[model samples]
Target: MKFSITTLSALLLVSAASVAQADSYADAIKSWCGGLAVTAPKTSTVVVAGAKTKITVTRKADERTKTITGLDLYSVSKDGKAKYVQNVWKGNYALKSSATISDAVPKNVPAGLYYYRVWVTNLIGKQHGPDCLETSRTFKVTTGSHTNAAGDLEYTESLHDNSIYNPEHEVGCFGLSVDYPKAGDTFKLNQHIHIQANRDAASQTDALTKVELYKGDQLINTAWTGSESFQNSFSLKDHLVLDNADTTSDYHYKIHATSKKADKTCVFKSGDFKISN
Candidate 1:
């Protein structure tokens, strides 16, 4: 899945006259502007079946104070089909709030290419404006679980259509990446394996709470932990020793991160490789 940030920004900048010309739910949401800005995911995301995925709606206000009154989610398929998923929230919610909201992808949603959009209604001094925003890129829902060489469950993300294993940049509020052990690189037993996690720079008011490393389902190490603010790019590193692994099996490293700004925890898995005896 991929998100086009430029396209979304262009949609938000549509003139009121153009917005008025359309009569769709999306157009209606785009028509009103009371100085409330909504930011969605900046990159493609992937979630497994039956797993809870978070969708965070970040709001910025202008001179007028705005209160979020309602929130809804819609799913869009590859064939341009749109369906209402559910009402995420209703009633008055505060602005500039760091509260994280989340919902699970319907267990029945088949494995395929799809994207979600969030519609928000806000009140600015009795005036109501409903604005719509979508995930910058499409996301994937996989029915199969990913496992490592040890046959343990592993964290995973959708690869680009071209099958390239690149780190997700700016998922919701912050970006995550693995710098070392480029996907599919093999190593020898007893060789010191160093893993690195990088968080891209962001302009949101949020903090990264944790960065952890995993080998299959086993917790290898906790790289960093704290309420670290996201202002600049930073990296965390950890060393691993595979003493009990067999050379015939495939292996991979998975990075997990938690951020208050995101509705769901960020996860990215490395490409499969092996340990040569």
Candidate 2:
């Protein structure tokens, strides 16, 4: 399945909707701020399913110290559907700048794209401000059981960081045609990337292997093998074309490998890299 990032405008609308709902309840109370503002999370986040994520909510205050009573967290799906997951925090707290809360992703959460937003309430007044809501950038949740006994894997820009293969030890490696891009490498427009993964299977029909290249939750490229497997090993490669119009920003990449058979499925993920664009 493919994934897409939620746009900033859409997130704002989602936040507004949350505040609108909260406002209806706030109107019944006497002590409620006319407006409230919150800042969204800085960047997209990725977490393993069934894990706890630390979420910080910054309430934009003008002069007075705002007393935060509680914060409600909401989860949104890839199809632009949103639901109230739970209240992460419920207590009296003063927010000079911001407050943080912890939320746990349910163990049964399906592996897919999701986003989160926060809504705050006043402790003393018991009022929820319609304007005090912020939606975070799109995030991803990966299933935790993607382990198999295929073999350990590695990636290299060239033959630089490679060791001589021994039948008793290492099984395979991946390589990129371009220089090993660092975490924050900047690239000019019109640049592109090419990568390949080479691995040896136990037998010709032992495993069905596939390689995936992702930019955040979105799957950019995939390379897979059929029922036929290499007697010793096989390789998969692909290229990614860069955009030209956007010059001030960089692009991040993550590579993952998966092998599946009738019996089981295994997965490996590489650290993220960045390219200037």
Candidate 3:
């Protein structure tokens, strides 16, 4: 999903009903949401379904009126334009306060800063709440993140590249690990980037020569010419993103690796996985 970056301050939430009541809404967020922690996908870079995200909202009685409509995600760049990020999870609009929403990464989401806006929406646009009572959480997506794994090659998401494969800039630049994600662990696609062929693939001196993520036969995503290296520690923050997978299926990733002489294409499958929203 296309996205921008922004910091959310005092949230003035208005419901789908355009009536901003001048009444004191209790601190339902802390009351019902106290001690609530989300089981975030490891490494932040995750696949759409592989994203291990879970929220533990406390069960409270006063949190009756507050409604959690949509669980939004984004790819931010430290700017104020944090609204364009794609939404992976959209909670039930009329659900009560004690409701807990969960969803994997969205299929069509691009790379950028992501946030979760707890508010209502009408036919027009997003409804603003009376105060910033709506809870907002923020995260970023350079390559992406999710939880669990299937076999190993679960190419769930992918994006395009501009360099290596010009005939199809779509498949040349970036690759996603899984097109069909699993139930456990976190999976994510690389960002939209250009592939870089290395003069040498060893010595732990050069950056990533080539990066490609894929599904079974379908190419999920591909990217090259990264700015960092994964020789000792593989960092997903330096790659682009690509996502196109189901959150509940068992899947893995086939990271295509290339060196000076031999080109290594690694395929990873998953074990037993699941996805529920």
Candidate 4:
């Protein structure tokens, strides 16, 4: 909520010299031109324990490469200086030449240890070698709290789900859960983790999407699911925040669900859950 380190270091030096220079890499796609792939805000090291986090960056455009004429972006990080990235066609999604792009990797993220780089050239523009990649695992989203045997204190969140979804033709499965913080343990964040996907029930049946909230694996906050059909109605994970927390820290959460059906948001979700901070 504050920025001055020379305006975030001149926003990382005009985003790493504006993508180093852009010659090929589909002109470092801001839109059309084409070329970019690497599913997720993770190129390698990705470990999230909880507090609202979902960073995906999968965009593929190289059927001949060129035809976007609008919207495009993909960049992850580990201090991804190419100017602290994240641009996924804020307008929705665009880019030609055999097209392919996945968005939604920006939601109150603030833990350290990261790495990633992608390139395209139009819509949001910036191409060439930024096509870099690095991150075989080094992601954090800390926060912790656990003591539920009736001891109360049950504010938790744990991530690492890789469930690619599709149903029959795109069979991928990995699920997880440990949600129960409807509100109590000192919170002031407002709210953003109120999930209810997969079946979209009003009573209950594990339809808590994945609101997000953690300390040990670090993901400061996130509980907004107004769209994406309730953010996918529960596929990979993310969209539930009822526990409510913010004091000193509390954790003991582990809910990892993966399958992504086929990639709705599959960074790592094949099933996960644990809450004991």
State model 3's lDDT.
Answer: 0.34
What TM value does model 4 have?
0.21
Q: Model 4, stretches more than 4 Å misplaced?
A: 1-36, 39-112, 117-182, 185-256, 259-277
Candidate 1 per-residue lDDT, tens place, 185-269, comes to 7886545565554543222223456655455666655655665443333343333344566666656666555543356555655
CA lDDT scores, all candidates in order: 0.49, 0.42, 0.34, 0.32
Per-residue error for 87 in candidate 4, Å, reads 10
Ranking by TM-score: 1, 2, 3, 4
- What is the C-alpha lDDT profile of model 4 across 136-192, one tens digit per residue? 112333234478897975433433322211122112222222233332333233222
Q: Which candidate wins on TM-score?
A: 1
| lDDT ranking of the models | 1, 2, 3, 4
**Stretches > 4 Å off in candidate 3:** 1-52, 55-60, 63-65, 78-80, 87-98, 107-112, 120-133, 140-277
Q: What's the C-alpha lDDT at position 15 in model 2?
A: 62
TM-scores of all models?
A: 0.40, 0.35, 0.28, 0.21
What tens digits encode model 2's per-residue C-alpha lDDT throughout 159-273? 1212221111111111111123444545443344333323322110123355565566666556333442322333322334443333343344343332221133333344455
Candidates 3 and 4, the one with greater TM-score: 3
List, residue by residue over 1-277, the lDDT tens digit for candidate 3.
1111221111113221321221122233234343332224322333443354553233233323444555545333322222334555555544333455665655455554344444432221353333221322233333443354664443323322212112111111112222222435454433322222221111112234344444444555443333433322332222323344465454333334332112333222223332222
User: Higher TM-score: candidate 1 or 4?
Assistant: 1
